[model samples]
Target: MMKWACHRPLALVLGMAGLAFGAPGAEATESGASLYLLGSGGPGTAVMPPLEGLYFDKMVWVYDGSAEANRRIPVNGNITLGLDTTIVADFTTLLAVPSTNFLGGTLAVGVTMPLGAPIIDAEGLLTGPAGGTTLTGSLHDSALTTGDPVVLTQLGWQADKLHIQLSTMTNVPIGHYRESGLANLSLHRWAVDGSLALSWHDPESGWDISAKAGYTANGDNRDSGYDSGDEIHIEGAIEKALSPKFSLGIQGYYQKQVSDDRGMLGPFRGEVVAVGATAATTVMMAGVPATFRGRIMEEIDTTNRLEGTSFWLDFTVPIHMNMPAG
Candidate 1:
């Protein structure tokens, strides 16, 4: 019997990291809503059911050094560390539908909470009024965001050797938008985002292929001086099954800045190239099957890609309450 009871929180952590990393790109508008929410939910990804809907997965995860950029500041020479950290938690519920066709689908609705902030640490840059030598200090109120509750809907289509999917999400600022906790940053507004994905399976060739794409738009920023812009990311992954219940996969994505304005804030722009791998397995508990999954992603700039890399891990186990005893 498998109990992924403790791994659910791991998925939330990874989702939060995505929210942080996706904020700085040249195309990221930094407009209305919170940028943190955008990162938690990747592009073109929806609530997908695992293992024929016997059970759905709920997950949470956290990792550092995922995507951090160090740059020189003009005034003091303090190195600005733009870091991304994320958290997400959601449940999957299977809908009622007759199984007449081998290729089937499911719908999942849940909330994604993302929180991110900027931490400025100074190096040997210039001098401040207090000292004639190098200055060191951290910026206050630099990190601002919310991990709002996003309503998600996903459609999955699977067959003998092929599967495809699409998903969409809308963020509702339900947490303490002005007060910060658990997630760090604070927010006071809402937003919306959408994504789509397609995957193929070939057991004969011992390989699996998938492609994904997505977009986001901020609604309203309560703090002012910042706006969220629309963004896009496309990725493909290949998988090789090691056993009936185990597999290893590698995925890569290209994220582009689609919007021009900085929303209400000044213009800051860049693009990203993401590469990563995943390991997954299936387990049975109480005569019911569940899935355990993990993933890590490394991101770099495409044009003048940054030097540092960001990484995170995700674990998921679906919970299906309505499935009849099999």
Candidate 2:
């Protein structure tokens, strides 16, 4: 079946820059609750589920679709963030370092750059200090945000029936940010993420199951005066290979805010659960290897977080395997 150098595209959504408040079911705030989950890699993404660890190079792509509204907290009316008019993409390359093997395992590192074409539609009541309220029309703000780059490092070990990996992904705060705006692409904060995954594969039987979980620690946004909360996410999948080149499976994710938002927001928590389907395949191109994976997710349960559908397409092409050693 096809093998994927698992990577989460949600990490590329930039930081929680503008568009603070989440939908009704979602946690709305000016802190880290908007989205991005502090750049923590989501489930089915923190680790690769291959029977053998890959020591080659690869390039990846990703996309997300969603929309939400927030109103309960502010009586009159709330702000809504529609992602249908927003487009976010990530481009990354994973490279295997020469002699990166430890004992019998392999080590790899990758970097990701993100681009965003955002359409943030915001409208609600604005209350001034004089207790006067002004109703503003819906704002359809658009901006192209160049997101901060992400660095990912992984250590993987594989056996006959099981594979395990440890990973760390860090988000650098180098994207665009505006303290005042309907929406922004950059979170304007630093984040360090970690994950571990284990997978069991039986090639002869065409059965595979894998699970991964991750945690995130975030830095405070100076301009926004907000300290986003820490978060934990988990993902897992079960599948069967129909042929040497194809596989189909079920995948799901669960995320929760572990700590409370500080500095500018109260102690609030948000959580979400989603389940989806996935298909994977491998094809040869001009004697080169490429893999394609497609997935669709629907949120089943959510609190303080938006409930929406997300879809993604991943393409990985190996560039170079290894360098000559002295």
lDDT by residue for model 2 (85-189), tens = 343444444544433456667666666565655555445434333222455655666677765666767777777777787877677888777555644556667
- The segments of candidate 1 whose C-alpha lies over 4 angstroms from its true place after superposition are 1-56, 63-105, 113-136, 139-146, 178-189, 203-206, 263-265, 302-310, 321-326
Clashing pairs in 2: 15-187, 16-187, 22-28, 23-69, 25-304, 26-304, 26-305, 27-304
RMSD of every prediction: 7.3, 5.2
List the candidates' TM-scores in order: 0.65, 0.78
Best by lDDT: 2
lDDT of 1 by residue, 1-326 (tens): 13222111113212222323223332233311223322233311322444333333344433343223443212111122343333333323222222323345655445455444533222222333322245434333334444445455556676665556566666565644433221333333455556666656565555666666676565545553344445566667776778767777777777555664333223454466767777666666666555566666666554322333344434444444444468
Clash number for candidate 1: 42
- Lowest summed lDDT over 10 consecutive residues: which window, candidate 1? 5-14
Off by over 4 Å in 2: 1-21, 25-85, 125-135, 263-265, 323-326
